[model samples]
Target: MKDVYITRISKFLPNAPVGNDEMESILGQINGKPSRAKRVVLRNNGIKERYYAINSQGEITHTNAELTKEAITKLFDDSFTQNNMELLCCGTSSPDQLLPSHAVMVHGLLANKNLEVNSASGICCAGMSSLKFGFLSVKSENSNNAVCTGSERSSTRMMASMFNEEAESLSSLEDQPIIAFKKEFLRWMLSDGAGAMLLENKKNETGLSLKIDWMEAYSFAYELETCMYSGGEKQEDGSIKPWTEYSSKQWLEDSIFSVKQDVKILEEHVISKGVESLEMVFEKYSKDPSDIDYFLPHISSNYFAEKLKTGIKEKGLKIPESSWFTNLSSVGNVGSASIYLMLEELVHSGRLKKGDKILLSVPESGRFSYAYAHLTVC
Candidate 1:
């Protein structure tokens, strides 16, 4: 059993910004009162605030495929090109369209780099899945220089009139409490953003930085159809339209079962490779949870964060303030790019040193959990 290492990482976000109080205020106004909006405002999204790209009208700005291109360009220039890279991959949900797919477009944007570029799109977990593929690419002799970027233009997906109309209508009636709760939750929780990263096979001078270990990715085909977005229908305006509805309650329910199964699979496989228990995985691979120094969590809300915390406790792990990056409190959910954003902070801050192991975890999306080892502090 060999391990794959991550050489470099990077992230990108839209220019707009939003916070919890602002969200609360908006919902309060829409719902007609602060008291009325309380339940919707107090979920466990781990995000106290988040950013959104907006236009001159101050409405949420849509994710521009061009912006994603710019972010990836920046990442390559600033993060990994110097490693003498050979491959590129982009993880995203906001594609140029349903046909060519985002990856192929991004690959072309890089001027047909001749390196294999995968623009992968599969909801939230596409980011992690892309990385897993990149690692396997490196380990299996498919490619050595790999860069992965995960970005989303969720703002583009907002169904404003539909949302507001539904919100207002639901506010007026109490017919189906469950349905009402689900709709409201999705409206308030989903957000718009993007993030990117650069990876390479070459070890730097000191050789003490982040390294990838092992990645096991699985998707339950049975649950595939359970979550999806229908193709846009042709409109009288001669344009296609996407379904704006998001099933949050369905998503949450499906996620719990998916994550449990995925994690169980990863635990069983990795443990057999000598990475037993939460403690052994940390200690043998790098450091103990107690001495981990910091925890950069991929949390979307408080409810999600508490769920992760419970998972940590169940595994007998301890978390410290330094070990956690709570940006979700401000960034809503950046989807695929969440962990990379946190990793970028750790590196830029110079807090991470060569030889210090940073344990990274992703509990959602693909209903998967993976821990990677960043081996050095450079």
Candidate 2:
């Protein structure tokens, strides 16, 4: 197979940056009361401001497809446009509707002639999955070029209205006046944005391009239960009861459709599994961690930053703090869009030089999966 390169990267963050204090105002209060977990979650996530598709009035300014379109549009210029794009791959955790696939909706928004479209569905690693599809397609000579996008219009899901029914139901029972931390904690953590990248068989002639050295993903679902999820409830047996299994009334009462995380599972498995996955990838490729010039990790919260460092170091990959790059503090956790956003910023930061090696790591708490990629500056 031939080599592939990322020729261009772009991102779109909807609306103005909403500060920590402005989140509750934009998302509104659940049960007409402020979130008890908001402050704690925000403090741990270390996000000062984040973008949201929802305006202050709670009106949605853009859907997930629209966000993906906007970012993809930014990838083109007079020399390259939608007419030249041969393949499109979109990934996301939050799509506007359940019926149409997210990539088709984005293709509809772009109004481009039909070519090939694929959608990768999951949490954060979904973005990397799309990138991998594009890279492999170009590498195998199946496509001349591919446009890959990762986006989330999650603000709509995080709105107070989504949880008000469940919170009210809990209040009525009086056994618990608030929703569980598993359901409410994510409200403060996730934001909205979209990012797109162009992949081609040849590197750019005039500017820098990221040569795709390798990309690999691993899943431990057989060895672990779900740790983060939405549109489902975690049962006592550690299995998920899908949204379809619940009645509409039950959906509203239990917030079965709201995003939730089994924090205990997350705390116990995420870092350790991530380290093990990375070690396997490194061994497979005979890669040495000390050769990395930049390390970009999609960490959901700053709380895990040091823990991830310790875990990886114990495994012999000791990337220093100065070599690390992340925009999470400013952009918040955009889920599937995060790694794309971080890569976009780094590519445009004017810091890359020839022969530089960049390492990307995205750990998905959704059933404990991880994706790692190595790129070289050309």
Candidate 3:
């Protein structure tokens, strides 16, 4: 197997910041009670605070295409850009356009516009998926550097209709109508942020101890058509609306089902590679789960983490409390970019060491419940 190491990584949070308390306050102001907002604030999502982009008046901010450009440019400035960037991929949910992809916009913003750039638009899973693709591209070619950026401006879609949808699904009322004449609309949790990672075939001796040794992804029960996306809107007075309408609960169900199937496929593939279960796989590699300095679990929330923990324990794997890192308390779920952000945070804090194995688990889309586990240490 060839080695693909991450040389540099960068993340961006816009000027606007929102914390759990702040969210509670915002929800209270709109919904008439702080407790009513608790469902989205303190429960399913393990996030307490998030950042957003703001305009001149100082209202709660939304996503911006320009910010994405700014963040990408900054990432390139920090990372080594000696030659033309052969590949540029943007993984984002809050895109400026649905058809053209955010990748082209990001690529156009580059100091080296002459470089080839593209967007890997998928759901939240697109971030790591793009990274996987970018890593493969770098490994197979002479191209020394390629960039992957995940940026989102979530506020664009946040509306009362969406909140009503979330309120209904997360409501305590079990008897709530499954079928409503007027479907409750929901504004997705819109957090404004961006993350960029520069991958190359080089290694830094003094950087974080984390590295990528092996990575494999399995896609099963993949269905693009079954997936529903809001295409556009129906305006009231014959005018056009900006956002589309989709079922969040349905999205969750589909992703969960797909993830379960995909995990089975992953376990089979890993076992066929001569490693079985979490313990056997670690042991075969001559490393103990206990030896792992940090465990970066995907930030799906306490519910999701609890499920993953149950699975890990059932497999007889041991990871120390100190080894586990989570940012859910600070940043809600950044989707595909969450685990990567956790890894970057660990490295930037001067905690990463040489030969220290860091695990990367990425859950693709809402449907592909898959994780990419790699043991890479400097």
Candidate 4:
């Protein structure tokens, strides 16, 4: 087997940065009333600005595939272009359509020659899953190089129109009605963006490259219920009733297709389960947490940043706050693309040095899944 390295990284955030006060103007108000939870959500998430693929007029400027293609295009120069790509892997929780795979859609936009393509579907961890696939492919010598992408066009689904039906339905039963906090809260939390990375067996000659030391993933679905999801409803028994099981009209009335989260479950288990997974990975790989120079964690909200540090410290992993880095406050939460975006920024930040060790952590609340990876600067 051969070693794998991330040779290049790029990201694309659509349109201009939308400020905190501008979100309602862009997404519009549900039932002609501004969200009551918007201020609190934005404050807790600590996101002052974010990008949206949709304009103030609610016109879509780019699709998920288009965003992915734009990020991938930025990865190439005169020396490396689409013609040189051998394998393509795309991961996203949001896709333009449900028929064709996301990778094929991105490939169609690139208009490149035929190559091995794969798509990974899930929530935040989807990006890391794509990276894992590319890492293994290059490590096993099955592919000389691979282009991996993670993106999300979440604005299309977060529009107020998507939930108007549900808001109206609830209004009929009560004097003053608002959509559930679980669904309304995410509107202010998510944004639109795409990120891409190039993985190869050899490190870059001129600039810094991230050598993939190891990757690990774990799922607690058997012990936990779904916490964050879309196109389905969580039953009282902790099982999900898929969108297909609901009537067409019920889908709109309940906003069944819109993303929702069990905030209570997320707050209780997200950090604890992540620490458990990190412990397992450290034990299996004989990794020492104190050796990490930088720790990049994909946190959906800033509220959990300190909580994660506390939880991990209790487990004997003592990564200090100064060593932690994140761009969530500036870019907002991009779901599956967040880790990629964070990594892209760090790679270009001019802070890395030879022999530096970076640790990545991505926790997906979609049935409680976690992915961790270690990289070394070379």
Best by lDDT: 4
**C-alpha lDDT values of all predictions:** 0.53, 0.92, 0.55, 0.93
lDDT by residue for model 4 (220-337), tens = 9999989999999999998999999999999999999899999999998999999999899988998878888999999999999889988988888877667798999999999999
Q: After superposition, how far is residue 5 of candidate 2 from its true place, in Å?
A: 0.7
Q: Taking the tens digit of each residue's C-alpha lDDT, what string does model 2 give over 10-100?
A: 9999999999989999999888888889988988889998999988888889989999999999999998989999999999999889978
Evaluation by lDDT, superior candidate among 2 and 4: 4
Task: List TM-score per model, in order.
Answer: 0.69, 0.98, 0.71, 0.99
Q: Which ranges of candidate 3 are over 4 A from the true structure?
A: 24-37, 55-64, 77-79, 82-84, 161-190, 205-210, 220-291, 373-375
Task: Report the C-alpha displacement of residue 79, candidate 1, in angstroms.
Answer: 10
Q: Where does model 2 exceed 4 Å of error? A: none
State which candidate, 1 or 2, has the greater TM-score. Answer: 2
lDDT of 3 by residue, 133-158 (tens): 77777777746667777766655444
Once model 2 is optimally superposed onto the true structure by TM-score, how far is the C-alpha of residue 234 displaced, in angstroms? 1.1
How well is each residue in 143-230 modelled by candidate 1, as lDDT tens digits? Answer: 7657776677655444333344444455466743222332334445555555555555656555445667444433443332122232
Compare candidates 2 and 3 on lDDT and give the better one: 2
